[model samples]
Target: MTRVVELVEHAPAVGVALPDAVGRALAAGDIVDAVPDPYVPGHWSLRAGSKVGAVAVATPGNDEPITVRVTPKVPITRLFFLLGYNLDPKGGWRDGEVDVTGHRDLLPALAHAVERQVDRALRQGLLQGYQRREETSLVVRGRIREADQIRRRFGATLPVEVEYDEFTTDIAENRLLRAAVERLLRLPGVPHDVRRRLLHQRARLVDVAVIVRGHPLPVWQSSRLNSRYQHALHLARVVLENASVEHAPGALRVDGFLFDMNKLFEDFVTVALREACRSFGHSARLQDPHHLDEASAIRMKPDLVLYGPSSAPCAVVDAKYKAEKREGFPDADLYQMLAYCTALGLREGHLVYAKGNAPHAAHRVRHAGIVIHQHALDLDQEPSGLLSEVDRVAAQLVNTPRV
Candidate 1:
């Protein structure tokens, strides 16, 4: 049996007698901060940051593995909603689509949801498409490579270098699905039933090529032909990108799937605001880069920059997720927004933050005429309410008078 240690996000550090090898592995993993307690011998103080998920590390001499699970401040359902909306704003994840009702942890919920989506995607049978192939064959096929055939097989006409398109089910879409399945299978703590279903899904994709570790995933374009795969592919991407796998020294292995709520909040704010304000005939850019100095050396990236029809930046916005629940807006954020306004030649800027103790407030720089507004978004609400808050912010952003 494995020993479990549960920690809540942004909670106070607690001392636990963790194995030296496990402590070193967790430190290297950066999933959480583990420090040797000075007062307590053979104990390490563990603290969870904004990241939340489970990480398991195998001890050297112990047969049972020790798992560290960090619970997110937001409910799992809301977290999934944020993840789903970020992955696909246009019908990628709906309320009833991937049911995560009974799941108490992130991994099981994510695994179960992915299996469901993949199963639905392959119900119509594996999608077949044309794949480009280049090889050396004894018999001439589609077209022989002229230069290669002469250079390599000089005076020999047996094996020819040829290139052709092969129609098969082993395409990028199926390959991505297979890769996600394989990833989940390797992870620990997946429910028995979910694992069984994932195996069945893998069997269906037996013909697809397995994605090599650390290699770039096969790319697929969205088209009417591949429309059925869009949902599964997006979710699959989340798994491949966010999960971490590390091999420590002394035969210690660490496997984890974590989500940085700060990044998630920023993504949701920027994406949702863009979509909410799209109907206003203006466009929004996420992580829009700009130079702060005349030398073009100093660079800055604002979370979102809205442009008017004339292609001029009309408004600037930044997203801040406060894990500390502090009382006021961080002065650094206001100064940063002020710099953005000065560089972009905008009079008003916006800072959107997760709901904190400080309510909506506006501050005007004394020397500069720029005014910065801080807006709070409550994550505990329903999807509709969260997006409604975004719409409110968007309206204010659009209505800011132009210079």
Candidate 2:
């Protein structure tokens, strides 16, 4: 049996007694900060930040494994919506496409969603496509590499180095799906049924090669042929990119999947704002880079920058997962936005937060005359309402004077 410890995002730290090895591993994991209580013996205070997921560490001589499950402040459903929208804004995820009500935590919900998506993707059978192959073969096939024949083989005639495009089911799309299935199977706390389904999905992708760990994944392009696989592949990428496993001395192993709310919020806000801007004939650049200083020594990347018909940056915006101050947006954020406005020669800027003490506020820098607006977006609302809020923000940007 594995002992389960639960924590909430941005909540007060909780004290729990954990094995010394487990405690130290959690401290070093970067998902949470574990501080040993100075007054309490054998106890550690655990606090979670923006990252949320389940991490399990097993210690030597301990019969049971300890799993730390951090719950996100945003509802899991809405979080998935943000993630889905970010992954593919055009046609990736829709309301009720991924059902999360069945699972209690992130890991299980992710596993379930991934399995279902993969199953849907493979419903028509594994997609087969051409993959480039380069190898030495006894029989001559495709184009032969003469340089390699002279260098390594030394003009050997029997074995030839050839390159060819082989048509097979083991393409990048299937491999990504298989990799996500395997990743979910390895993580802690997946429901038994979901695990079994994931295994089935793996069996379907038996011919696909396992992606080499720590190497860049094989690239796949979106086309009409692979249109059915786009959603599954996107979700699969999320699994592979965010999950990790760590091995320590004394046979201790730590592994889990975590999603950073900050990044998620930023991605969602920028992408959504970009979509909204497009509807109004304005173009948006995500993470647009510019310099804050005259010498170009200080570099800055605003979350989203809107460009007018003349191809000049007319508006700048930054996304905050949550506001820093309890009364309103943080002063530091306002200061940063002012810098963005000043550097970009824009008269106004916007800061969007996931939530805040105030719904909206505007500050005018005394010397600069640059006005910074802070807007709070409630994540708990329906997807339509949330996007409507984004539309309102985009409307404001369109109404701002050209810089």
- Summing lDDT over every window of 10 consecutive residues in candidate 2, give the lowest-scoring window: 322-331
Clashes of 2: 0
Candidates in order have lDDT scores of 0.87, 0.87
Q: TM per model?
A: 0.95, 0.95
Candidate 2 structure quality by residue, lDDT tens digits, 221-330: 99999998998998899999889755564678898898888898999999999998998888999999999988999999999999988898989999988666546654
Local error of candidate 2 at 199, Å? 0.5
Q: For residues 252-340, what per-residue lDDT tens digits would candidate 1 score against the true structure? A: 97887887888999999999989988989889999998899999899999999998888889999999886233365547787888899
